[model samples]
Target: MPSFVSRIVPVYLRIARANRPFISTEGARRHIRERTLRPQPYGPPRRLRADVAVTVDHDRGWPIYTLTPRTGQPHGNVVYAHGGGWVNEIQPQHWALAAEIAVRAGTTVTVPIYPLIPFGSADVVIPAFADLVLANRIQYGEVCLAGDSAGGQIALSTAVVLRDEHQVTLPRTILISPALDLSLSNPEIPVVLPTDPWLGHDGGLVLGEHWRGPLPISDPRVSPLFAEMANLGPLTLFCGTRDILWPDARLLVDKARGAGVEVDFHEATDLVHVYPLTPTSEGRAAQAEMIAQLKTALETVRR
Candidate 1:
């Protein structure tokens, strides 16, 4: 059974309708303008934990945040991307997860603040991020890639670009409720659409078009669901039945496994989108598992 928090999240989202902006093109445009014009420390995320030290840097003119634990020197490195349907900025929840990974997994986490849609798109973001990952791997000797939702798409796309274009193989990539196919064409999407309190198919396509830029909806650069999967590192995926992206997550598993790429998928039966970030039992467990995976990679890096 879903925990109480799990059950109430959808109700809260319905009430907040924070995701309502993505329900239509006009709302998305307006939301983008509001965020871009009046940027603050965060859009609508919770306060970050004080256990870690966070510093901001820049790479190729994009802002990068590095979280290092107060406990000691970090043993490994993680490069994270934030997801907000390709339009939203990094939230405090994203920072919380990055800090958690940094402290618990005994690693330093670097999160790149990529440009959102109308200002940035896949054509410019992917290669630049891939280069940053490559530079991180060179600096740390080993690193992990992680993200949620659209950020997940960017992380996986970075890994793909690293493999096919840069000839680098990552050890692991963590994906949470990733938007594998921006086209929102999966038949299963509408089936879950009603259950999904936050995402709307119509608004998704509009944002997809903007983020996709000149690429077709099916292009591997924009929709990693169509990317070649061989020779990449292991993959870990998380999704819930309440998210419209669930079908694409399932599709990614099948495709990745068919290509002989190792995949670990955690399907949250009764949870909502990006449940791992919420303060729920299921979310905590999912995060615990993610930390353990990062620890494993960190261990390997130490050897």
Candidate 2:
């Protein structure tokens, strides 16, 4: 039987969904404008206080936000990628989370603004991220790559590419509600559709189409579930049972395990995708748990 909070969670999600458009429209538009009109040389500083810097990637410029610890030399660095279905979101919300992990794990965090789709290709963006990792490897040592949603896909793909193509070694990776399968035909979609407040099948399809362009939907780079994970680094994946991507997350875990890779998989009961970004108490708790898990993973990497 479902708990009382479980029952109420869906109801609250529905109410939130009804109001999301009005609540998010202005902020979304503002973000779009800032992402578009901001000069390439100058990256916008987030409201949060962190060491902000910009690095040039080929012809394009990328922002790197570094959050350092108060005590102790950094254990390792985390390269955090922000999620927006490959197009719509930015790195503002990630700053707080990055700081939390940095302090808890005694590490520094470097968050790069990877080029979103339609504007850049995964081939381009992934290599740029790899370059960032390679550039900082000496200062940061072994790095843990982390991201949510589409950003998660990028993180994992970049790790795989680095290991396989560039012979680079990443310590580990953390994925939150990762969209590993771009096919979007997973069996869990319908099961969680009624309760997911932020994303829908139609929305995913539209976004997928926008990002894929001329490529086939099954391209392994776009969908890491189909990619080779044989020698990838240890991975930690967090997904809610009520999320549409839960099935894909599970499948990815199974594949990683079968390939003899270490994986830490956490499935939160009765929660939705991107739950950490929600403003509810559940969201806060989820974000806290995520930070804890990331801290633990970083500690493991350091040891």
lDDT of 2 by residue, 1-303 (tens): 335565566687687663232124353444345546652332434455444232324333855656777667777678888887776546556666766677766677887766664576675777778878877787777777888988888888788878877897566788889888776899777887765666666557655655565667777667788887788878878887777788889999999999999998877777767656655566676667766666676677667
Please, what is the TM-score per model? 0.95, 0.80
Error of 2 at 107 (Å): 1.1
Can you give the lDDT of residue 100 in candidate 2?
67
Per-model lDDT: 0.87, 0.70
Against the hidden true structure, what lDDT does model 2 obtain? 0.70
lDDT of 1: 0.87
Error of 1 at 167 (Å): 1.2
| lDDT (C-alpha) at residue 139 in model 1 | 83
Give the residue spans of candidate 2 off by over 4 A.
Answer: 1-13, 16-60, 278-303
Local accuracy of candidate 1 as per-residue lDDT tens digits, 256-303:
999999999999887899999988999999999999998897788688
